[model samples]
Target chain A: MADGLRVGVVGATGQVGAVMRKLLAEREFPIAELRYFASARSAGSKLPWRDTEITIEDASTADPSGLDIALFSAGGSTSKAQAPRFAAAGVTVIDNSSAFRMDPDVPLVVSEVNPEAVKEARKGIIANPNCTTIAAMPVLKPLHDEAGLVRLVASTYQAVSGSGLAGVDELAGQVRAAAEHASLLTHDGAAIDFPKPEKYVRPIAFNVLPMAGSIVDDGEFETDEEKKFRNESRKILSIPGLAVSCTCVRVPVFSGHSVSVNAEFERPLSVERATELLTHAPGVELSEEPTPLQAAGNDPSYVGRIRVDPGVEGGRGLALFLSNDNLRKGAALNAIQIAELVAQQL
Target chain B: MADGLRVGVVGATGQVGAVMRKLLAEREFPIAELRYFASARSAGSKLPWRDTEITIEDASTADPSGLDIALFSAGGSTSKAQAPRFAAAGVTVIDNSSAFRMDPDVPLVVSEVNPEAVKEARKGIIANPNCTTIAAMPVLKPLHDEAGLVRLVASTYQAVSGSGLAGVDELAGQVRAAAEHASLLTHDGAAIDFPKPEKYVRPIAFNVLPMAGSIVDDGEFETDEEKKFRNESRKILSIPGLAVSCTCVRVPVFSGHSVSVNAEFERPLSVERATELLTHAPGVELSEEPTPLQAAGNDPSYVGRIRVDPGVEGGRGLALFLSNDNLRKGAALNAIQIAELVAQQL
Candidate 1:
């Protein structure tokens, strides 16, 4: 216990930050001292840690020199501003935002897929892949190792929690307002009045919006979430030229994010062999039928419905579905795992 | 009005059958006389048609000698048992079931895509495509015609109504049971006690189920709904050798079914040209962001999010999304449109 490390959590009041705090305690991470930090608005508040309350520090103004590691789950802007400052103070930062993921010096690491890459973080900052991308890494890494994966067509069913607490609130409010009108929705979906949507472009209660993130105005018509899936997959898998077409959609589910992937490999990959590989794959489990409800609050990415994609000639294609808790394995747990890797190196 | 043809609707007490009756009146389908038929249990019941109550007749025992056309929205077994009987009695039968869709003697028709195929119904029975397949037909028809589509990868966000009234009841019951536990669900989805699911394998209220229909025993790991999309799309588009991979997922929405399609063509198809074609295509409308709520009770298939697939070489692939009313354009309205074509010939 005396050899334990001192750790700090940035944006400790946010949704993913809260999950990080819970998981650190649940997993019994080696911690000699724990600290919480948020914006100035939440700085003076106290958060409970191991039967004691710790005063929150303002991340923008606080000194992080004494901390061995800091997990950042604040938005991109906060990470862009505070990550380097904390890192320069000798605190290794495992950031869960997109701000530093694409930086060449800052390795984008999935703890299971690329934990060794943590040593390559010359900037003293390791970037955790996007939650949607993180869910697919553990599932795709094993497949890519067996057969050279060439092309991928992925369609996602994302949950509201990916957008944080506000998304949760919007979906909950709409569901409460419209649950009694389920009969009316069965006949005419638009007949009832839903509270005007604030977090999403459409109602997220009993509906699905194909646009998950705001579209990038580069005339490509791909959302940022879709782009992240393609970019982060290639970087983590070390397949620089991987062909990917991704459609990210927001569904009514609250916690889990699922993806239906049709992958074309360079070599012939049979369903049986793929299933066997996935059966033994780390951080993955095989299910008969994978649903978001089964994955919520779970650690492993549940994968199932493996089949040969007939669309690809010579049986070189495999189609499968996977679901994972967006908050657990997707964000906080992965960041914590990266921190663990850094701890080992230190 | 005097020259109008006599029409009959089978399974008039069912969900799609109710939509059939409503559309028949809304479209003013030149019905000189209207008749209703269902199973023996509903045979003696009364249904309204044009302000007049019509007593339902037993579909198994009814004589159809005088009716010019009969629309069947019953289950597959009912269609197989009664469609041939009605057709043998000189009534053209348009079936909304999977019973005869792959039958060579029966033409699988999507009214907007291949209305001329109506003449090839050699058995006097025309089959409407599955609701999930129907949602993509109008959106894909023009692009295929322009680019000679060769391969397709589709992932569906299907509504509960596609599963019939029981599915609707299961989802509604679960939503009503779990709506108040939204906060709990946002953190731990499985913590809430949802009603035991009957129509679906998993709770469908706030979850997405990857297995939409039961898996076919052919060892392909494909659901009947997924197989239907591949088989029906090939037949309707007249590309018998087209390669297709489809994943059918049931969402929480009630009425509209949506598909994300990545289509590869023999010739390069530009996003601009595909958008232009879809803009003018019959039974298709272009929207900025298409959702199920917007497509419910609508006649056209709403399409948007057109992009060039970076995975396909030479700009030969395009990606798009579409939504349509699963009950209307997918089942009931399509059957009625086929009836209209048969009426023209009669």
Candidate 2:
């Protein structure tokens, strides 16, 4: 597979990092060597990547002189401080956090949506779009290319994992509470217990919460996640000034993210044309049967139920649903994809 | 309390009926007498209302003659055929299905939205709006009264019980299938054997199914559930041509039906004002923190996350969320309230 590439994973002990390592191994990336980098809390531990155990270095104190590339899944703060240092050493940083996405100098991407943007990653920090936006872009961009996206009204069913380990813990606790006793609230019958809310602001067991991120600036422009959807779409599709309004919520489901998108187009978009286009679109899987669980652990963005928006007349506008693995396409897989492209260019 | 009323419950053994019976007992409806009716399969089965025992009659065969009022949670076929007979026998019928909801002669009522509609049940059928519609109606109607509803876009996360016990079983079975290790298609996860396919069309475990009923009329307005969301909203809200487009999904959630709605009004409606209105609106409980589990067995149509629709300008519109016990205000509680209104008019 050409010359094998040397790879380094940042935030190696975190959820997205673990997934990144797994995907790299599963996809059989031709790795000549592998290394991991984490915070001091996880220094010296080794991760199994393609049959080799790689030592993890601490970002603050460890040297990165030999690494060819470093993938960062740590939160925004860590990425802000460490990404540049690694890049200064001539290592490309494929960052999974939101740290550099909005910077005009740094390109935000979904591999299939805007792989071309990678060349413009002058800052060395290539940003991954928010998971919710990533799941939708692969499907919508192609359609929008055909029928300009004039405006959109969307809602999302985001899985707990979007928040990481804490999210998964919250749901397990809430569902247990639902099983144990009847809630005075409504009627799921016996409530089961998981834990008191140590993570999310509210109990998520046997329940769904609409509060994704704190109300975005008086609940105006967008929730933090919602804005990611709008601005990220603009950047990825290379279409600025696109009007996108979205409502994103977190549900009890453990892994995939699902969105119901209503797009009003400048021209008309018939179901026939849209479906035919999506049928062959890269990174888009036409599921005539899209659902959150069916999307769990899979890579392709699942699209289904194409119909007229009725809100917008004709074949001119339409609505559909999307679900995809937030951890993979949403984070790790996309990072690996960028690294793959960089390995070629370097 | 107003000379205790005699009540009969049709489909008493079904999911909504069971909930209806529980609500009747829980709310302590002023019942001097109570009777249970079901399809032939459940005939002779016992239903315990309070400390008393009542045997369910075969709704298809048993006459509706001896009741003061009958609550029909039975399916539409039963409602269409039997409601008239019950009304002819001097029993008012509060139907929980779509059979008569759009019928001009039948008053579509949600106690809080249109208790007055009960006075207009001339054809003897007091129709209940579909569950998803009812959950949002009580909250939306008040907002509509203040600001004319221009358009509405909604996505629902409905529980299994909306389909009945078999639905709950289907979801339960799918969860267990994970332990057994089976591919999604061959697993047939719906538990009750009766829970399997030929019913839901696809698996329901850990997933969300976008379309709820069969694709009717080539899917322009497919699914019996979708039609009800459209048709029922029109009749109940007095908007003959309301812009109601929806994606009704069945989630792994067991009870409440949660909706994410983006509603536009002729005049501007702020999220704060909607919250204020909902707090005092009849039949609506203002949830400081609204969630599906918390609103489960409760009676209120809880509304929260009121915010202006960023998609629209003019400060005239808002988008919010709702989670209500589909069995309560969406089904039983509403039916009972309609029955209450009919008794008063009589």
Candidate 3:
């Protein structure tokens, strides 16, 4: 685990990839050489890595032999096509997409929660858990380890940035267009209005869409984001029998994704002691006022509203609110942590 | 109880007050005479009601001699002063503020769920249930009747309109500023920004805030909105033993308040039957795709995502999402419904 390492970030011009670059610079990841790759659309785009400008190369045509490590933030389609090639070239691939996450061979790792899982990465590429799963794992791991997580009911308010740079730009444009008293009555995806809703189906300026991702099949009328919540939680926490029901919402928020979680544990746990435990827990920042904006750009998951359900005696049931940076801890931070852990494990 | 009744609307020019006028007109309330009253700021404002323009009078100093019913949507301070005065003059006050909702004698009415409670209102001022309560009641009532509701664990994504026009302007302004790429990072509330955050603590543009009300005394770290949720649900549902723990959040959405609720019932109820019941439930509209925008300007509480929780299967638990116009069903609509019901009994 020496200081110098060659690192390459795929989808360099995308949202998570841009943050990966920023985090590398901010966290001072000991990079001897840095390479940037993107799709043909953003092929020659210049991405500022700290003060150094790195020109993006087309990922499909780019040679991966020079890079010691490659971070993938491109969509699942791109990651599926290119990751194995990079991995086969002996580059340790850390993916931030859903492509190989649920593959039995790939180990889904969250550094602070499951650093040990990285050791089981037999397929060369280590999978990063979904943003929602990434956010909750830090907070849940400690509690789940202590009392054994029985059931989890989570309702997520996911920020637009989780979608991509397009998400941020779309929301920004909506905010601008909604400023002038535009008639919302005649302006829902119709005419005579704002940025024309390029990102979302509806005007996100003043609305929230409950359905996030296509309602892909796992049955129970669940969206792909909701399925990710269940599948990822099972993999990360190793709670295969865990009863989880999630309603993932796309809010007008920009960065961090916030979840209100009701967790029923096997044994009793007190709120007072949980607060004391979280104060000492790693990667879990305890906040009296936890909001999406406060958790934005931060690495730690901000947890608050620690209380026991009076319906359950001996504090077996607890409710909490947690917010995590969808870009950082939710994607780039976890990937960086995994890289750091890989530097240790390998 | 007749087909026509004299009705006076207090704080007519204000936010919820304007919606009260809209709902009343849209529903075709049998109004023999309609009077509009507002603060000194809106004393000369003209309001349209059922194809007639009503002249607004100063509510604080107005004579309340002959009105049959008075709906108050003004602030708590205004309600504290004017409600009793109007009530003393024999004009039944359907108050919309939290000033008197908890009072035992006052009937907190959500007409679809608790109309019978209104007949027992000895207090002239009948309290309108909290907006959150109003949105959740229709679905909970039928289910609670069939199987006793044991606990409700909820997280709310409330709309800005629930606060008032100032909130709408706050959200709109923050979006505008964020769009123009104005400074939000260093915004200390200096006067230059167009969407300068005036109503909330942080910029609402592309953000979700957990802090809705001032951190009041909740024994522990529970927010005022959280406490309101717990206490208000108890009063509205008439189930004191219903354990409720809620995290109230302000989303990027503009109009409707959406809630993710997990309720445990005494008898084992299936999601199939629950869906069938909620499909025909009063004031509740079951939607496969419910968004904050669609619920805006509509009165029905939208419900979906009905799934069975195996953890509480012995007690029959269902996870559902509820979205309703916070201004209408939550504030103005509920108040007007109470007025409509009270008009029948008068």
lDDT of 2 at B301: 76
What lDDT does each candidate get?
0.90, 0.79, 0.81
Candidate 1 ranges with C-alpha deviation above 4 Å:
A180-185, B180-185
- Fnat of candidates, each listed: 0.82, 0.43, 0.49
List DockQ for all candidates.
Answer: 0.80, 0.40, 0.44
Full-model lDDT, candidate 1: 0.90
TM-score of chain A of each: 0.98, 0.94, 0.93
Looking at model 3, what is the TM-score of chain A? Answer: 0.93
| Predicted candidate 1 versus true structure: per-residue lDDT over A191-246, tens digit per residue | 75898999887788778899999899888999999999999999999999999999
Q: What would the C-alpha RMSD of candidate 3 be, to one decimal place?
A: 3.4
Model 2 docking category? acceptable
Sort every candidate by lDDT, greatest first.
1, 3, 2
Encode model 2's per-residue lDDT on B1-346: one tens digit a residue: 3668888999988888887888887777788888899888889889897887999888877777768889998898998888888988888888887778778888888888877878887877788888888998888899999999878888888887888777776665554444234332221122212235534877665556888876788648457787788778877888887887788888777778888888888888877777788889988887745677777778887787777776677877687888898877778888887877777765
Could you give the CAPRI-style class of model 3? acceptable
lDDT of 2 by residue, A1-346 (tens): 3667778888988889888888988888778777788899888878776656777788877777777888998898889999999999877888888888899999997888788888998887788889998999989888888998877788898888889877775665554444444342133632544456877877765567777876667537357887788888888887787777788888767778999988888888898899999999999998877876677778899999888877666556787999998888888898899888877787
* TM-score sort, best first: 1, 2, 3
lDDT of 3 by residue, A1-346 (tens): 3657889999888778877887888888888899999998888878787777888999998899967789999989999999999999999999988999999989999888878888787889999989998899889888988889888888898888788767767766665555555554221222225556777776665677778777776566778898899889988999999988888888877778889888888999889878877888899999976777788767789998777876666679888889998888899889998988877654
